[model samples]
Target: MTQSPYVLVLFYSRHGSVSEMAKHIARGINKVNGMEAMIRQVPDVSDTTKMASPALPENGSPYCTLEELAGCSGLAIGSPSYFGSMAAPLKHFIDQTSTLWMTGQLIDKPACGFTSASTMHGGQEQCIHSMMTPLLHHGMLWLGLPYKNKELISTQSGGTPYGASHLANSTYEISLTSDEKVLCEAQGKRLAETALKLKK
Candidate 1:
């Protein structure tokens, strides 16, 4: 029998807000029986240094690779919003995945995105959709939260059709609202189940 595929949860977090959302998604991915979740983070980008990054991260999740993107059954990408767009560091990482896109390795795989911002009106949907563009170009199946997720429609905090999101205040105190958490878990579980079905 073909082995179940792993759903890779890739993201970049500056203030740990987006990292919190990634964890919620991983929690949902873990609910599936056969599928697995792998969490990874990308290194920061800098103008001064194009030489290379350290072999190991100082702390937090390890660096991601194109191999991980190619091997995974599905992808969950997250980023913090920077003026209605994904942060520069996350964009830098995604830009490097063109090699996988060129090989069609990500084709037919299911993918989704999420984001966190420092305000209720901080362009959550825009940020998530921003990350979706490259994945769509890679020919991956895009997964979105359905309206049936009641928390999505009723959320006074942060939740949307694009994906999952959280609202952070000035202090960057990011908490996944109940609605945000539910939607994130739902997104992860949905991706895992879909990956299994596709594998079959």
Candidate 2:
């Protein structure tokens, strides 16, 4: 049996906002026929000495593997905003993909980014751009939400042409707004469609 083409929805979240966004993205990916979404997460990094995280997370998505990253038809990476950049854990995982970069395993694959920040001005766009750097080095095609989405023009919370994003408020209490959710799903569908077209 042939395996279905899948988009790897990879992300890291500290307070669950980004994780929830991943689910909505996956929903949109699945809406595309002949495509599937493979949601994965990276393990947290330690500030001190390197200590291994458990083989599996205590809950939620399993940790992503390099093999899975290489095999995906498309990619969507999400991370929480950390000082206008992606979180350390997700960046650490991306750093491990040098082998994939050397082999050109990710070259030409469509990829997009997403991020959630704790404040309206909490560096959401910056985080998305920061995440794109590694993907660009891997030679993947960068994708961003277009103004055609309409949400990009009207959303005061988190939609951006750079990618999908959400504002969690200072206390991480704000949920994804209707516009933000639409943009997230639209980004996923757009990525899936692009991947499928490229495969042909």
Candidate 3:
């Protein structure tokens, strides 16, 4: 039997906001008949002055492996914003994927990014760009939500043409706006469709 095409949804969530966005993206991926969504999370990084994470995650999704990145047909990477950038744990994980980079394992695979921030102007777009850099180095095809998605064009909240985002608010409630949800789904669909076309 032929294998179902899978999109790997990899993210790092400090306060659960980014993880929620990943689920929304997965919903969109599943909407496509021929695609599968594999959701994974990265371990938290400690300072050299502190301890690394335990071998198994104490709670949420399983830790991601380089093999997941190598085998995925498409990718959606997300993280909580850290000073207008992706958080260190996710970046640390990506930094270890040099073997995949050398072999061009991710070349031409469709990829997109999302982020969550604590405030309205928390540099969501910058986080998206930062997440895309390693994917670009691996030669993955970048996917973004198109203006055709009505929510993207009109969203006053966390939706962006770059990718989906959530304004976690001052209290860090982590609720996704309606537009944010739509754009996450749109982004997922876009990446899956692009991967299918590239596979052909």
Candidate 4:
């Protein structure tokens, strides 16, 4: 049987905010017929040594593989903010994709980014851009949420034309705002639509 086309919803969430946003994005991706969402996460990296992560995480999403990353019809990558950039774990995973870049396996695929931060101004946009840079290097078409989503104009919390974002606050207790959810779904839908159009 033929495999279904999938949008890889790849993310790393230390406090769970980015993971929640990824679910919303997957919901949006599923809204497009003939497409599916594959949610994956990267393993945490330790500073002490280059110890390998466990084969599977104790809970949450499974670790992403380079093969999976290269095979996706589209991609929605997310990472929690770490000093105005993507978290170390996610960046570590992206760094291993040089082989994919060399082979042009990811070229022309549609991609988008998402991020969550502990504060409203905790550099969410920069984190999204940080995630996009590698995709751009791999020759993927980077996509952003358009202002047409409406949430981009009115969201005081985390929606941006650069990508969907979330403000989890210092306590990390906040759930996604309605505007954030809308924009995430919109980003996923737009990516799926674009990927489908390109496939034809």
lDDT of 4 by residue, 102-122 (tens): 999999999999998888888
Q: Write the per-residue lDDT of candidate 2 for residues 44-105, one digit (tens) a residue.
A: 87896253578889999999999999999999999988889998889888988989999999
Per-residue accuracy of model 3 over 1-200 as CA lDDT, tens digit each: 85578999999998888989999999998888788899999887788623278989999888988887888999999998788899888888888999999999999899999998888888899999999998999999888888899987788878888888888875458778888888888888888777777888
Candidate 1: 10-residue stretch with minimal lDDT:
46-55
How much lDDT does each candidate structure score? 0.87, 0.91, 0.87, 0.90
TM-score of each: 0.93, 0.96, 0.95, 0.96
> Hey, what RMSD does candidate 4 come out at?
1.2
Tens-place lDDT per residue, model 1, 1-200, is: 75457999999888888899999999999999999999999888778534245768787788888887789999999998889999887888788887887789989999999988878888888898899898899999999999989998788887888898888766378777888899999999999999989988
Displacement of residue 114 (Cα, Å) in model 4 is 0.2
Candidate with more favorable, higher TM-score: 1 or 2: 2
What is the Å distance of residue 24 in model 4 from its true position? 0.2
lDDT of 1 at 175: 78
Instruction: Name the weakest run of 10 consecutive residues (lDDT summed) in model 2.
Output: 45-54
